[model samples]
Target: MAYSYYAYTPSHTAALVFAILFSITNAATVAQWIRYRAWVWLVMVVAGFMESLGYIVRTVSTKNPDKKGLFVAQFCLIVLAPVLMAAACYVIFGRIVYRVVPVESRTTKFLWVPPGFITTIFVTCDIVALLLQLGGAVLVSGTQPTQSNVQQRIQTGKNIALAGLAIQIACFGFFSIIALRFHFISKQFDKRLADKTTDETTEDEKYIMVNETQRKVLKNWRPLLRVINVACILILIRSIYRVCDFALGKSGYLEQHEWPAYVFDAAMMLPTLAIFVYWHPGKYLPYLGFRLPKSRRENL
Candidate 1:
């Protein structure tokens, strides 16, 4: 007989808990974005909103496990939400690079044209991934009633989703290398600044300290970059966990088990967004010349 519902159903209590949490988080992010007028947060806000909706649907699916529509909507929303989160992190790197990495220190002055061109590349990749995964889910959702046919379609969809996630992983890896390069460049600049001011050893030598503001800027830069990078690592780990799940297919341990998905995907994602909620770059980045759009700037 053809399967009537998902092979496994999520726990209603657990889904409800997650749904509430995600809703609260999304609301808080939206409020913060409005207060700060950080329109850049629109991407993350949408992702968070999707997450909340997904978990709500997940809760509904728990009550009616045979509702294929609910299952498909939840699965697709949850799967694509992180793609947006990843794009937000990519933009953060561009903002930090613009502020901290001097034009001369960069490989090419125009490398990140239109301000956040590097971030734009990552966003484009994310959109590609989102489309593939969404297409795959739509295909699987419409599979025939025959058990074998349904399984086959599901597998095919999984494969497509896996391909998209792989591209995202590659983009993230390349972006990491660029971020590390910026770190080294900043260190080199700091060293040069110290050497130039070596003779100004006196405690009262404020004026003698070459580029004091620049050095202070770097100091501020490190903590914010470190926090966002940590968030990036969390998202990367979540993606790898998902890629493994897709590779294992429906019968695999990671795919069959709810706990692993909760731990690796939901738990990891929660804090990744939380970090940005607490440490929004928009509040601090303006001082470093990474100003919001002039139209938004007027409101601030």
Candidate 2:
């Protein structure tokens, strides 16, 4: 049984924009995952595929505005899926922090005393919140449209999504702090490790995590991180935006507002795609340069 009742229309402009963006991001992140191949990246791929399908579904929504089932499926999958991806990103952060900054000298991980433990607590809460949202959606089909029960379920689902986004954002904030510490640690490391010179062989390979390298060393994180960062933001923003879009649908104002469509497809999706378009590392080999074959690279 489906939950959401709203049907969406395609904004030709927005859909085109989102389509182009999704196609691009899809390639970049896939490239990212191919090299990393870390368990978390696998999870991220599932989540990313689902999110991309959501945008595709939105494109479907544009062509046939009356297809309620398509609308509901896209909304549920697209909206809920990204949170899980963000969760995977959350999991990646701990190891990343531990790696870039050695635990002995690390202040950021345990800066608040409990360290990664605190994030674990938040992850647990977010999971419960996500489950509740999924469970609540199930009840929607059985409840009368105007009944208090139906209203309660809708509100519960939206609230749960909101809670998840809020916590994830908070998690990002903490991670950013740790990443800052990582930056400082990197500087300190460069000073120390620089004197020793890097070797292509040895034990560094044993513990070296694939995700730690900034998207590109020389290009900087501004672009790659921006794509991924915005990817997370889009996931978060999509959640809050849905609540308003749905609420406004009930009140009868959603169709008239062009901003919703524009922001989502163009403002949000395009820049994200551009990240992939601009940062595609065809020249650089990933996953220790072995997980992917030589044929896959274009040569630097």
Candidate 3:
């Protein structure tokens, strides 16, 4: 007799909800990309597309739990999609730090820890992590009654996937610390300067100075900083959940239950994507020194 374990039937309602959510997010993201000419955010667009597709696959799987192909497709897409989103976040934050943050305020070595270097290292790691996860999924897809080594292959693949998730969590966590440090140092430096200037200036001068400062910070860096941090944290949590799921082995509570996947994966990832709709990096990249050539700018 074939043993049926954590491979329970998926909920139709849950799949539908994710499908709708991802679709809406995808449309909004595409609109943002088009309106802003944010070609750089193509990676994010690809991530959203994968997420939508994964949910749609999940929706199909709900109707047929025994369909191995549906399970594998959804598995690969959902697991790897966030890697691309995290990469996009790294690129955006790196550019923001390089352009907006004063060289003196940054604790990291500007030459070695430049945004480009940080982005490159993390993105490379994300690619490696993604490949490891996908490879694991492939290896585990052979689980069937007739397959003698199915359990071994599945266990090995799960371990590889867990390692990948760990790497992702570590990368995101390290970058979050770096980002928070830079934010704190810059704000502290700005505050001290403001205090000295206000003490020395006349009332009228102080008012103008304070007003201008507020406008500058609000318009330039604050919103992007908040959105990026929140998005990263959300994805980090989702990655951590995935790590636990894999850690539990094949029959783990999280892995066996469809609801956990919906909550940790879908709910967590949706907000991360939605955050970009309002604070699309394209809207602020121009302020970060990213620009088209004069001729191109004029034509647009």
Candidate 4:
């Protein structure tokens, strides 16, 4: 039997709609990057581009489902795009630490890793996962569906992809812990600041001097953090879905049904992009080339 690129015919309407949506989001992300020059949103721009292109190729796949090249291209783009988005999330969290947390607290470290290096650590893990998934996607896409050993090759590829996803999940888990820790610590710090007497000369008060505008910006960090946490949960749900989808093999119900992919992956990721555009971090964080207000005591 010839290899079936899709168990059910791909939906042209759905693919085209998603392609357009992602394109719009990508354009918006580019605009945000141009306006703010924040490097983190640039990562989101690339992910959005990949998503748009993937759906475009998927639209083509609806017409030419048996074309291995189209299948491979869409597979690679859609699978790898989220990894980049996840990296953006990591970078955003690091920026939040720098922008909101007091210099005194973060100067030492946050969760055993310096605030500056958070992006480096998580993104390095993301890169490793991306490469692994890419390799697995190629292996799976290249296999001849009718070969006697086809099932075995497919299983090998699935295992590799699963391994990459496992790493991503682990990273998210650890990152969440760090984020929650920071959240609680910041909350306590804020409370202490609120309770301080005007005449008190505590270390925190000395270090936390900021203009009214900067203080307002710092106050709004919680909303951005909540948005990020929501995005993280959606991505985690999608990741878990992918794991189950692959574990069931080619004959699995997920592979046979088209709706599940749209519901679990497409629907989930669309909002992830939309939320960022709506509550863009650039609006809250200082524009590129500007630093958050430095500690007044340090200047003296």
Candidate whose lDDT is highest: 4
Q: How many angstroms is residue 117 displaced in model 3 relative to the true structure, after the best TM-score fit?
A: 0.8
* Number of the top-ranking candidate, with TM-score as the measure: 4
Q: Model 4: residues >4 Å from true position, as ranges?
A: 1-3, 107-114, 191-219, 288-300
In order, candidate lDDTs are 0.71, 0.49, 0.73, 0.77
How far does residue 120 in candidate 4 sit from its true spot (Å)? 1.1
Off by over 4 Å in 2: 1-9, 35-39, 107-126, 133-150, 180-186, 199-249, 252-258, 261-300
lDDT per residue, candidate 4, 44-127, as tens digits?
Answer: 888999999999999998888878899999989988888888888888888777655555666635556766578889999999
- Candidate 2 lDDT over 112-136, as tens digits, reads 4244453475457557656654554
Candidate 1 Cα errors over 4 Å, as ranges: 1-4, 108-116, 141-148, 189-219, 287-300
Candidate 1, residues 59-109, lDDT tens digits: the string is 998888767788888988888898898888777777666554455544444
Q: What TM-score, over all chains together, does every model reach?
A: 0.80, 0.62, 0.82, 0.84
The residue-level lDDT of candidate 4 at 45 comes to 85
Q: What residue runs in model 3 are displaced by over 4 Å at the alpha carbon?
A: 1-6, 103-107, 110-116, 188-218, 287-300
lDDT digits (tens) for residues 183-293 of candidate 3: 665564455435434333443223213324421222345578788889888898889888888888667787677788877888989999999998887665553223423
